[model samples]
Target: MKLLLYPNCSNGGVTAVIRSRANADKENTYLVVFTNDRGGRHSFDDLDNVTVRIVPDFRLGAFLTYLFNEYVFDSINVFSMPKIVEQMVQRDELAVTYEFHSSNMSIVEKEISQLPLDRVASLVVPSQEMKSKLSERLPKRLLPRLQVVPNLVDEFVFNTNGRSDRLSSLEEGLIPLVWIGRLEASKGAHFVPRVLAQLPENYVAIMIVSLESDPTRFDRFLAECDSMGVAHRCHILMDLQQQTVAEFYRSAAARGGWLISTSLMESFGYAVSEAISCGLRVAAFELPVWSRFEEEPKLVQVDAGSVVQMASAVAGKVS
Candidate 1:
């Protein structure tokens, strides 16, 4: 059997899932990916069995090119694309499977509704909450096709074995706090400075590994940290290698601090789980996605706009 995998969003979870499927299956598989917003090609494309087709950002060109490629494949597996569903629904030989990872169920429902339900052989959702939500929205006949495949980081990349010496040098009474993700408004980078301003001096050493796509916005975040006098406590990691990320995890874990996920909206919260997998605890706001994990005791659910509550939550965990 063969599979044509389309991973539209270049988020880490999407890449990890496709890489897992491609590497595990003995059968022939082709990876059809879009140009990464990030400068580099996918790290996992070293697999000899997989062939990749990178499409341009132009929708019309991508649609035509992707439609042309679909003709050669026996089955289509789309991570997210409304047009792909439309194209494949018209084909007889192609079996369709879609993996839904977006936080917006309404958008997914609207897109999936256009495809012929009979052609859709399977539907994969990252979180059980997302699966349940889709089951509720989908027609009764289509509900049986849904499968819950939770999102997971590559365990090796997130391993916690390398920071023994670095962690040993921590100041006598300071906790370590880490926020790892893109430093953008959606990631709650704005709220982080507010939280830091309210915290006590020398209470914790904060490490921020932000892979910001926009330089202007990245500079703004740095400016906020500097103007607030929180720059000393935080280090903004711009070009983070996977190995360095693992070291950050191990260093923070050894120091007994928590990894904070302050994203206003996270479909599955990959960082939260990465921290958990590293044997570190998390203190995230109560997003429905966060509830899917078994760390509610450590969670501090807050209103979407509650900066004070967010600060209080961080302080509660660190102080």
Candidate 2:
């Protein structure tokens, strides 16, 4: 089937999730991504059975590109746009599926509820927590349409031999704690310094790899780390390839080390899944879905907003 996947401006993990679907069942699928010019840059550039279209920003251009031509699509998969769903309905498209992330559900239900019911096929969410929230807020009319597809780990990520070989290269006598994500305000970079402060001297190094987005916030995080005197033990990695990311996970798993997620919000914890699947331990804020991990001995759960608690959790696991 021809699936037209409409990705709004922000494409991070969502693009990966979509690409995973396309890559999974590549033979029978024709995946077309309708993106604004700004959404063109992404890590999922090498994907096959996927065509990228940069729709124009102007009203006439948008209407002609997205609205008028949408009927050619057999199915429409939308991530983060109520207006696009409205336009799809206007064009008489039969099946349009909405993928929900933590940030967009409120706007989805609040603005797009009046659209013809059957045309909206299903709302795919990553976690039960998000599904619960969607179920609670969805107009009773749209409740039956929500579908939960748990976030999947990209199996291609784990190259066991490559990870094992990389693990051998690391310096001996130090247990590595690897973290990778964006360096931003909401990323809880502030909490990281505090988590490090409570660790014992023997816990060794933290390789905190992040894509540097805002310079001011990045500087603030480093400054706080310096003030805490834990800066010397933290290595800030800037932009590595996906295979290298998998290697980091492998190294940690080899050493029986843990991966930590301090962020306040995540629709689905990508690193948490990658780490746990690689057989490494995990620690995170007791957010809705993350709390579920604590039941597994491999994962350590910490109270949200408590650095000492997170550090203690990690320290206890590592020791």
Candidate 3:
């Protein structure tokens, strides 16, 4: 079947989802539509059976309709596009599926109103925790349509290889740490500088500002770092390729660096998982979603909402 995938946002996790599906399902003709704001090296873009288009913002619903009229896909799979999904569901001619990626209550209320849950083939959530949360807000009729399907990471591309021994090459006395995420409140961005302030002087942080992060928020984060007097120790990097991310992870791991996640909520955390897979030890908040990865030995779960605990946990990782 020719399946078309539409995602409302362009973050690393969403891009990874699109690329994974196209690569895994080679027999099907896959068409992917993204807004101009979504940018990533979509590895499947060049595949003969996969057609990818980046249309302008707010034109997505109309663009998908245009593609539908052109008969570009046999069925449609969309992530978190509520109003459009409702419109598509009303159309008896189209086969559709809706994916829920957020656990935010306000967004959940919108889905409860706008998503025609009974009309679609399925309602997909990325994690069981997300499903449990949605189970409360979504209509009982929507329950039967719900399914849990995980996002994928390319094992070969993200694994611990093609990395340098950064341990010996770096300054001998310093311990490095890394943080990767959108500079947003739910990610616990404000807590980062606080955690850095509590850590010892020998420790320094490398902050990787992800795509789609708010520049204003980033400025605030820097100001927080400056106010805490740790701005000089915080290094900011941006727009790195996947290979480079993996390389950073591998090298940081070799140098005894830890991957830190201050996020208060996550549907599924891509950066933390990828860092662990690439051989980095991790110190993250004890989010309920992380129960899925309880067996990972390298992970240290700090008490959520406590900067002192996170700093203490990260410091403990060094020993």
- Per-residue accuracy of model 3 over 194-239 as CA lDDT, tens digit each: 8889988878887777765457887888889999999888888875
**Comparison by lDDT, 1 against 3, better one:** 3
Q: Sorted on TM-score, highest at the top, how do the candidates line up?
A: 3, 2, 1
Instruction: Write down the TM-score for model 2.
Output: 0.80
Candidate 2 local lDDT, 1-319, one digit each (tens): 5665554423335655666677676675555555553333454566666665555444523654544454466566776655557656654545678777643454557645654545677887888778887788767887788888876667776444555445565566566666666665555767776777788654544554544445886788789989988887677766555556677777777875678888777677877877776777777777777745655777777778888777777777432
The global C-alpha lDDT for each of the candidates, from Candidate 1 onward, is 0.65, 0.65, 0.75
Model 1: lDDT of residue 82 = 55
- The TM-scores of all predictions, comma-separated, are 0.75, 0.80, 0.89
**Could you give the C-alpha RMSD of every candidate to the true structure, in order shown?**
4.3, 3.9, 2.7
Cα-based lDDT at residue 85, candidate 3:
72
Off by over 4 Å in 2: 4-12, 30-47, 54-71, 103-119, 159-161, 165-170, 184-186, 201-213, 291-295, 317-319
Q: Report the number of clashing residue pairs per model.
A: 1, 0, 0
- Cα lDDT tens digits, model 1, 186-270, are 7777667666777776545454544455688878877888888887776555545444556777777776676777787766787
Ranking by lDDT: 3, 2, 1
The CA lDDT at 6 in model 2 is 55
Would you give me the overall lDDT of model 1? 0.65
